[model samples]
Target: MSLRPLTKFGYLGRTYKFFNGETLYPFGYGLNYTRFKYSMVSSSHALQLKFGRLQHCRDLTYEDGTARPPRPTVVVDDITCGKELDFEVDIQVQNVGNVDGADIVIIYSKPLVGIKETHIKQVFGFQRVFLKAGENKTLKFTFIACKSLMVVDKTVYKVLPSMENMIVIGDEELFLPVQINIASCQN
Candidate 1:
């Protein structure tokens, strides 16, 4: 019996130009790597004076399944005094299993203070960090608050520091508790 052209499974829309009945497994296919660990060492949050928004505030998440709900730290932003602040998010990637694997790092920031889901940026910033057999990598990411967040009405500003108002991290939004004076918030 003959099969219909349209009904037949063909590689008409696949990335590869050719198709065959036999399954193809390219090199590195099915290759699995060992699990690694990632952790957040420290983080800082502050409100920007000129931008009227939080300066250099962000959330860190490790690719490791065991790592979640990364801890956050509040830091002072005194750029003038050469006190530049950068969140040194600590992450560890280890190959727990016999086989080695690679992991991708993702950092998400949402204005949980005064912005809604619609206002948040899509495709949260991401960084790819690779790990080898029984190896780990410590990563650091600097987050700068959106400039648009500044100049918001004072009423909106009040929303900050309030648990109700904060940047959304992921599905579970986290409202970090922090207060920054104008003098110390100069970035």
Candidate 2:
């Protein structure tokens, strides 16, 4: 199918999602004379955040005020971002090459399978650091799980519990698996 019809999703021409899909070059595709190595400095479970079951919208009628069969929808205003969902990931980037240079690190989040019509991946956070040859720097990326981790299903914002959230870095796809938990929930 032509991606032209997915105007709502914008152009599928760019590699905003799937990393392993057939493509010449995708997001974070860049060339550099110097090479960098990325290693996780934080705990693998550092991304633990809270999620809760979604509640359906109370307005049962259609937008035009016509009564119809009830459908699952989220109340846009009712959605709240709690502190329980804030987390951070720390990664150390070392310039392994013999030349000093600056590199931009793009953090991409691969959506959990439970969400439908989801992007193959989405940008979470990014950082650019200039490191001397053989120098290494630690970069901290903060994420409000409710924001970057949220997905709109049927036009309503919601977060679902999943252990499949994947974070990829740079031109190379480094898989970082994270578990999302439900805690101190707000109804």
Candidate 3:
């Protein structure tokens, strides 16, 4: 009796779609051989700073040299929105002695105070970096916020009933938050 079926594999269909140009996707794409490292050089306090430490997920554990979930991660240093803050992030990327590689750096922000949930605001920028074998690259960033734009209270930005008295005295306090993301070729 024949142990194999007569049906073709799914790979064939995917391959055709990739090369046909009829589809928007490319075949054998998204494959990489090199790796990348990321490091912050500095940022402008006028830009608003945001960053965090890298850590593994708690739900994942290794018993006998096994892998786990929630791999390498970048945590955000929560900051109050609308408030001005000055900080810097330094990062370095070294080729793991394999081959050439690249990386993409992303930064984000959120509202710190008077927000029900911490929602992602906007993307700072995308940095495309390349590295050579055994070579390391560094990056620095500075961040800041505009008070006029960040103050969520209508009184601070405009005029509110409750803020009338405070407006007369002066401007109130506000805080703005920012986030960071680092992705390597390996990930």
Candidate 4:
């Protein structure tokens, strides 16, 4: 039998996707020859922002961990949408290893409010950087709501009045939701 069939997860198999119900460690999680430390250099406070009504032409379908069927994820078009509510965050990465090495810095985030029960943190940004044995660098990451947060249809953006009015950044979860009172998306 294949490794998938030998494990106890059935067809789901033993993979990073099903790390929760099982006791297996997360992928890439183990002792490394070199150690990397992460710290919060700075982050913007969350705020409550308002947006116009969001319009969806068709229902998108795809594999979503939260939903047995599927869920909505932003595409490239809406991901590029810009607004004043967007913010930036800085993270300090230090290579505490005896030898030089490179590491990829990943940025994860979640809405103070859940996005259709997709509560797990989703990646928004990442950058590959190299460092010396004792080198430390500050990386800048932009918190684009359209890309990382928020839901949209075909055009325009929408905000849920009942949703949590705060944006939570990973690491410290600097929650400061910007409430946006959207009238409607009529066009």
Could you say which candidate leads in lDDT? 2
- For every model shown, the clashing-pair count is 20, 1, 26, 17
Residue-level error in angstroms, candidate 3, position 2: 55
* Residue 147 local lDDT, model 3: 26
Candidate 4, poorest ten consecutive residues by summed lDDT: 55-64
What candidate 2 gets wrong by more than 4 Å, as runs, is 1-15, 18-21, 46-77, 154-163, 183-187
Query: What's model 1's TM-score?
Result: 0.39
Give the Å error, residue 180, model 2: 1.7
lDDT of 2 by residue, 87-149 (tens): 788989999999999999898776555344445667878999999999999999978765675
Cα lDDT listed for each candidate: 0.34, 0.62, 0.32, 0.49
Best by TM-score: 2
Write one digit per residue (lDDT tens) for candidate 3, span 25-60.
332123457654443343322332333333221111
What tens digits encode model 1's per-residue C-alpha lDDT throughout 60-127? 22323444442221232312222232222344445556655665554443333222212232223445
Tell me the alpha-carbon RMSD of every candidate. 15.2, 7.7, 20.1, 7.9
Ranking by TM-score: 2, 4, 1, 3
**Cand. 3 TM to true fold:** 0.34
Model 2: colliding residue pairs: 17-121
